[model samples]
Target: MREAFDHMYISCWEWSISVLEEVGATKPLYPPTMLRFTKRDTNSATPGPYSYPAMTLDECQLADFSEFETFDNYCYAMFTFYQLIQQTSGLSGEVNLEVRSPRFLETVASKDDIFLIEGMHCVKFKNDRFEEKVMAHWRREMPVRTFRRKDRA
Candidate 1:
């Protein structure tokens, strides 16, 4: 990280609270927090993208966000993740894309969002598996076995 910063310019400016204050940004945009996990959404009537991506953090982390320059920026960061869940969703009748590891999270948000944004080492998006009964229902013409979520245990 330092190498890249040093390479860009002769004078390597350090990012600090004072610098942020000078620019009217008192704190980091997104504080370190945990990515809220999702459970099965049973409501069929609801929209297609059932889950909303949220960040969960302990009291310490929440306090960190208090240093944010603007609440709008903070909230925007949250909504952006939810947007990604929608964008990366699988094809029709398919499952949502998985956030398997730290690397994949970078696609939607910045690297800082991975560590500071989600405060998690690994973020994964799980696909639902289709059950045998579901397949049998479509006896005339069944889609691929991986078309749906796995059976609920």
Candidate 2:
């Protein structure tokens, strides 16, 4: 359980970095960016321990969270973090960098708002021209792969 939470945070952090870069941000709107892995037990009174030291933007780089490269995956990761926080103690139940950064605000109408879904809290953002631009940027930035066909012998 602790391992899963750690994975979720790390995944979200990496995703945040990618989104920020895509939006052309020099740094997270918030400082002392919380980029690290933490694990918490199920116990309500216990505090989670940080596995890695907090990293600065220059020192932090994306990890292989490719499986969560899609927006759906990103939302799911956030939802998972929300759930984990509600289930544990000494864990922060707050909005993450990806959802609150000013860079994202340029592309969306709002980001700091939260809504309840099926009794769980989640972040919401309105789509705008920025979404289209981001898609275009991704299309240009991502590498295309091809496979060679073998000739019949």
Q: Pick the candidate with the highest lDDT.
A: 2
Which residue pairs does candidate 2 place in steric collision? none
lDDT of 1 at 6: 18
TM-score of 2: 0.23
Per-model TM values vs. the true structure: 0.20, 0.23
Residue-by-residue lDDT tens digits, candidate 2, 73-151: 3343344434444454234443343434433333222432332212122233222432343334434543421111122
For 1-153, candidate 1 gives per-residue lDDT tens digits of 111111111111222222222233232222123113433344632212112113222322344433443423323333333334434544432222243333444544343332223344433222221112222333434332111112310
Q: Could you tell me how far off, in angstroms, the CA of residue 85 lies in candidate 2 after the best superposition?
A: 15
Residue 37 shift from truth in candidate 2, angstroms: 18
Provide C-alpha RMSD values for all models, in order. Answer: 20.3, 15.0
Q: Report the error of model 2 at residue 44, Å.
A: 36
For model 2, what is the alpha-carbon lDDT of residue 53? 31
